[model samples]
Target chain A: MTGLADRRPEEDSVAMPRVSFTENLKRHVDCPPQDAAGGTVRAVLENVFADNPRLGTYVLDDQRRLRKHVTVFVNREMIADREGLSDAVGEGDEVFVFQALSGG
Target chain B: MTDAFHVATRKGLFRYERRNGGWQAGAPAFLGEPVSAVLTDPRDGAIYAALRLGHFGQKLHRSRDGGTSWEELEAPKFGAEPPPPSPANAENFEADMAARKAAQTVDTIWIMTAGGADQPGVLWAGTLPGALFKSKDHGESWSLVESLWNVPERAKWFGGGADLPGIHSVHVDPRDSAKLTVGVSCGGVWKSDDGGETWRQAGQGLRAAFLPPEMQYDPVSQDPHRLAHSGDTVWCQHHNGVFLSRDGGESFTEIEEAGPSVFGFAVATHPDDPESAWLVPGVKDETRVPVDGKFVVTRTRDGGKSFEALSNGLPDGPAWDLVYRHALDIDGTGERLVMGSTTGNCWLTEDGGDSWICVSTYLPPIAAVAWA
Candidate 1:
């Protein structure tokens, strides 16, 4: 599986996905507005991690897969692929990463 | 002005700096996040904070400039197990079950202890689900200590606070860096004399009242609320009572008369005096509070033969503050001690428990306190 480090920008510019993290995640990491360019959900996330390396480990596991407690939504729908994170992404898509912070 | 103490509370991390003649509370770090453990690396002045976000899992952050700023780092993560082979039949059921058990995430970094003087950048972290992690690059990276996790006795361990057992104490012998001891909740004292290459149960004489009479003496079933290392002795304020071991945790001797109630969470051992240790006693496990609703701290100067209740400047009535396992600590001078409680109250004593002063009374439920 290709990680964020190996992705190359396409010749035809793809609309950068706007990535945002939950407030709980922002507490531990520096999460600001950033545009991620990719064709798939995995690529956009890899782009997000490329800008902020540490956040990757928080949202994904060592296997480069989404963490169990982490949820990622593409536009209005939750991504169906967790293992591959290969859900397709379109230009202008907004990716939302939610970390369920509940209970004591 | 030296910053001598730090408190890890449910809300955040607070450093107590000694200014003029008293300790002053500094601005909080990781504000509004629960910090379970905090340790200052005396060798490099780096501060490591273990923050547990209920939704995002546990994380570790380090500050090289006292508590000025922090950089989040990779937390200890259990190795992932590969998916089981196809064909869900009885032949592969056992292997499937074992693989699932190997991939548990670290729910919390329950305890953090710096390595000895000669072992700079070497640190040990204990976590929930009862696992150990060691980092050689300060708090930058960590690798699980699989030898201790694979111990056969671990199968029987269960959590005291959550559904999974957790490790709350990790003590490295100052005299010998390779010799280490760990205290686990629902599990007993464990020792690794060969730098964690191997481990063995060290609760030979520790007792648990909740166990069956015949199982009371079992080694792996002991619940040690807190463990403090002083000189060559290891002092444990267990769920049942106080215990002491002089021979590196090979065996423990219960101190029957070591408290006003014998049930509490926090315990601190003087850095230079092995005989002097402190404990804050609550009513009992079920009714965890001050005895008769009066707060007091018990001290022992004669190796736990007897205990003296210290309440000079503390609340005297209807005060039910319960101190957690890591909320009490003694400074390097062995004279100044600081303790915080679940009720958001903090106290300090510069005269070795002879008297006390309120440090703060409205912070947050303190989870850990360390005198750096």
Candidate 2:
């Protein structure tokens, strides 16, 4: 029987999505590029936040809604559900987070 | 008189120290950021500064060793649960949802005060969108005071100068930590006798001239810009005029003899004398400049029976300085007072309000000043 360490590299990459944050956000909180496993935008972000709770505050509000000044994109397209964050995310997709231009 | 004071401004937090017999400003902390509120905890000398960042949301920092360094702390925040529907708007589900959404987020930390001297490490903060929070272990963590937030009368509170109503004043009775009072813009005043376990509307005589004649005396509709206390006597710089309350905040009597004009924001009450208080007067409403472009500080020594305008060392007419609600502060001795204005002007009065000296003509627009 094959163990976990014997899994192929391609299988690992296809099971998770890549996530990145705006460079400017580093000044306030640390958010490094990494891979998170989730099927939807909310699930992916929640996975990341589960590791770094402080970063979540800078991106979302008390209601768990994306902050008015923060924007998220999945696979180069902006996520339409800011409040519920119901947008779908595919494995190996690139998720980018940005601070809205108006906030600056 | 105190040897140091802190000034919260649009750009940063400034610390002014009495050096060589004169006050001198040191380098600022949080420079280039909007310092909304600064609390110099007299009990332990811990300084907490609240910052309102355009993109990062409200942040709080505490400096244990003066303002030399700071460590960011968790700011007050509401929970995920939406507020209970108000009876006044229960029929309109859409409007109720909008109100709950607006109340869930903290906009700015308007004011913070240390708990009673006995309750060390205890801190109380009031925030915009009108919520109260308490911290029992210094500034390490905070929890919302749900009892006050859920009061039925809060539904009637509306905005005065901001889009959402804010609790700008929190007065914890020096004699008893459990007894507390808070002043809200457009929400009159509320008092909690059991350390915030419960609350009730308290400002009975506050009047709102801007409202309809029938609703002018409605306690929930009154707008109290600020509240200062001298022992048990409370002084309110209301939207319409200055009011004095002898029974804490149960009742108030409008002071009709304020110098220049009765409309202004800041008020400093003498720590030792209940009858003595100071006010900065300006034209009311649309024109918020000094009355006729003349800036003045009004002092009432006889329980608001009369007022004396003191402007010996201040700038001449054509000066358009309007002091915010927390910009003027009186030291513990009640003799030294510092006042800052919206136009970046700061004045220091060493002998009460008899004379003043311009400290800085260009600092940032001042938000609050407190003796350290």
Candidate 3:
């Protein structure tokens, strides 16, 4: 009901996490816009957080330089300028997460 | 982690320990310091201890008739386990010297378990990428079972908890050798059938609760920090809290009875009974908290059907630090228990956690400890 109440036919939709997803490493977070304006990686991610606080920690950190284990790809190739927000974001970009991969 | 050390909960943790040592230090907790030891033969009141893995892995010191005298267990001909064949290994000083020490350190028989389980074979030394090299012939020539490596999920190895492919605990059910379980730091609990010939990821239901968005697996710990078998249920001090599994990890039920730190490590089970176990929570921030421990040892009297917090004599109020599972133990005598924490404190209970005592206050973030 909360999701529906927030929806407006004149506006757009957002991507939100579902409930009871099962897994201890989880927190409640809300939706992201289906379409947003951002020609850069940080811009799009920030755009995600702008509408959903849940997407904040999931994408960016306190220092906000991509965590070593976290990888962001543009067309399946790894990004080089992980720090700068100047990296170009083309149409239909995708993000993938892979933790630092600790232990043995 | 700076203060993490070992605590010999009782004379039942491992099959080696001096009869009279204050605070009962068992198994010489390593990585990289061990202090105040009394390795004894016990029968003839003969005390002998091997304090080789000492500071900087430099020398091997042995003591007879307690810590009153010392000897060295080094043989010129013997060599440490060979390096993993990395030329870069030479660049790493600790690696080269450590390799030499590990290879040469086993020349003379010091530990009672060196003679095998029937004799003195309680501690099973393991290596990275997960290998079970047993010294059944009394540390003469180590044999690699390679069974753990062959398990289908071998690729999932260990990296989360403690950041290493770990074979931390080797549990032998005296009633049945085939009924064995080993705790992989981050990969969770693994059970071997037919003497470790085959293994299955018994921690299926254990989920990563606070995984970072970038985290592919739970941080360094296997499903949780530790695994203890109580009847059909395998309880653990998970990355989340106390968890229970029935049907040999085929399914699970989380027991909400855990914490001193919601973000911590280590979980241990009692020796004789299925209903008993222990956990030491870790403090998250840079500051150290508490004295004995934040949330002390918690146990389920009836196999986790129910649980109660056991903080009778433990450090209470304003405490923070991560206490691992391997550091907590219930002695074989069935009357005692203990937990070693990163705060440089070891809490003891000779009455099954009904009460507590801060026995030892100087040990590292304890890795593993056993009592004989």
Model 3, span B195-309: residue lDDT tens:
6677766665565665654452332334555666655656666656666666655455666545344334555565556566565554432333433445655565676565566
Per-residue alpha-carbon lDDT of candidate 2 for residues A14-39, written as tens digits (9 for 90 to 100): 65777889887887788998788898
lDDT of candidate 1 over A13-51, digit per residue (tens) = 455677878766765678775677888888999888887
lDDT of 3 at B366: 44
Instruction: Kindly report the interface RMSD of candidate 1, rounded to 1 decimal.
Output: 4.0
The residue-level lDDT of candidate 3 at B232 comes to 60
lDDT of 1 by residue, B21-107 (tens): 878878888778899899888788898999887556688989988889888888988776674333445587667656654557787
Model 2 - which docking category?
acceptable
First chain TM-score in every candidate? 0.80, 0.86, 0.54
Residue A34, candidate 1: C-alpha displacement in angstroms: 5.8
Score each candidate by Cα lDDT: 0.84, 0.89, 0.47
* True C-alpha contacts between chains kept, each model in order: 0.26, 0.50, 0.00
RMSD of each: 4.9, 5.2, 21.2
lDDT of 1 at A1: 21
Query: What is the Cα-based lDDT of residue B351 in candidate 1?
Result: 94
